[model samples]
Target: MGNRLSKIYTRTGDDGTTGLGDGSRVGKDSARVSAYGTVDEANSCIGLVLASELPDDVRALLVAVQHQLFDLGGELCIPGHAAIFEADIERLEAQLDAFNEPLPPLKDFILPGGGEAAARCHIARTVVRRAERETVNLARHDAVRPEAVRYLNRLSDLLFVLARVLARASGHGEVLWNHERRKA
Candidate 1:
């Protein structure tokens, strides 16, 4: 791990270049930075969902996910570094299985609206998908771990399932998209 930050304003990035953990600086618009920023955005979205009322187990799981996301950010900060572990992905898989087991299978596309917490979770899920796409783009140009990409893909799926679980728990149902009705 890098040294703990003692100051919040380094002013070093005033020129639009940010420093990485490996003492390298890259433009803020670089693919790596974009990937990191998207991940940060997803993390914030998850935080928003966590702010709402949720089951204790789901709350704990999201908390753990936040920590894993921080680890992912740290890994991005250091090129050629492997900070995200397999166990993290495994945990997501386990949670996905547990959460999806009781939920009815999806037969149609769903809209992104429901109870407050569930809706926020859907927003987070989209952000997670964006983060995954950005990470994939970054990996194409940078030396990124394949597991990182795989983890993000899995995480987005987990977030989608979680949103469904949250909706059901809150006495709301899935907002299935009505393509035919809209067309008609």
Candidate 2:
């Protein structure tokens, strides 16, 4: 980990093209770049969730997720390279089960609001889904590790469960959606 970004401004991307981990240049909006960029965006959303008061165990899980997301981004940036694997995806699955086990079963749709931390987790969930979609779009035309997509997909589920957990912990409760019809 030699300060890879010792000089953040390389001026190389000023021409609307950016360098990939393999030293190849592509348009800034290239599908591969967008795919990894969205992962970065999702990681930032998780940062918001981390800044809030939270249960220690949940916070620890999210912190590890941040590191995993960075590895996911690395896998995306460098062609023919991988930093995420099947085990990573399975770890998320285990967390998802552990977190969801205690949550009350859902009978109706829930609004994406509760306590501030839960709301932020909801936001992170949406971003992770978008990252998954972007990765799928990239995969349609290019080679992408299967685990990358699986990671994001599982991450959204984990975030949803974490949100519910945080909401209950905050005593604000889940914001259940109201399906009552209203006359316009």
Candidate 3:
């Protein structure tokens, strides 16, 4: 872990190809690269949400999620690598349930605006959803661990719940969609 990237400006990718964890070079726009890049984007969005003031428990959970996302990215970077597992997916499901338990059930569609932190969380949730879709597309043409896909799926769900929790924590509650507003 010491200076793993001491020389960050490597000219290896000047040919429009990037190196993978296994030392193989692939096009920058390859499916694998796109999948992992989306995962990285999701992690950054989560970081933005973490920058906002949040409850301690929520903060801790998001920190853990960041690490897991990095692992998931690593798993995608290296072919045949297994970083995400059933336990990771299960943990996300448990967190989702715990966070969702105290909130009233949804009666209408959510509009993704509750508070500053909650809005950021919603953004993160959508990015995670994109990551899931990209990973699924990659799986169509290559080998991918089932757990990796499952982890992204559960993580998106957890992010949705977290957004709701953050919204309530910020005293903004949820902004429900008005299906019939246009008729008014």
Candidate closer to the true structure by TM-score (higher is better), 1 or 2: 2
lDDT per residue as tens, model 1, 1-184: 8878878999999999999889999999999999888888999999999999999999999999998888898887799889787887898999999999999888999898779999999999999899899998998888999888888899999999999998888988789988789564
Give per-residue lDDT, candidate 3, residue 49.
96
- For candidate 3, the 10 contiguous residues with the lowest summed lDDT are 1-10
Task: Count clashes in each candidate, considering only residues at least 3 apart in sequence or on different chains.
Answer: 0, 0, 0
lDDT of each: 0.90, 0.95, 0.94
- The TM-score, computed over Cα atoms with residue i paired to residue i, of candidate 3 is 0.98
Sorted by lDDT, highest first, which candidate order results? 2, 3, 1
Model 3 Cα lDDT, one tens digit per residue, 132-163: 99999999999999998999989988888889
Number of the candidate with higher TM-score, 2 or 3: 3
Which candidate gets the maximum TM-score versus the true structure? 3
Using lDDT, give the best candidate's number.
2
State residue 171's C-alpha deviation in candidate 1, in Å: 1.1
Per-model TM-score versus the true fold? 0.95, 0.97, 0.98
Per-prediction CA RMSD (Å): 1.7, 1.1, 0.8
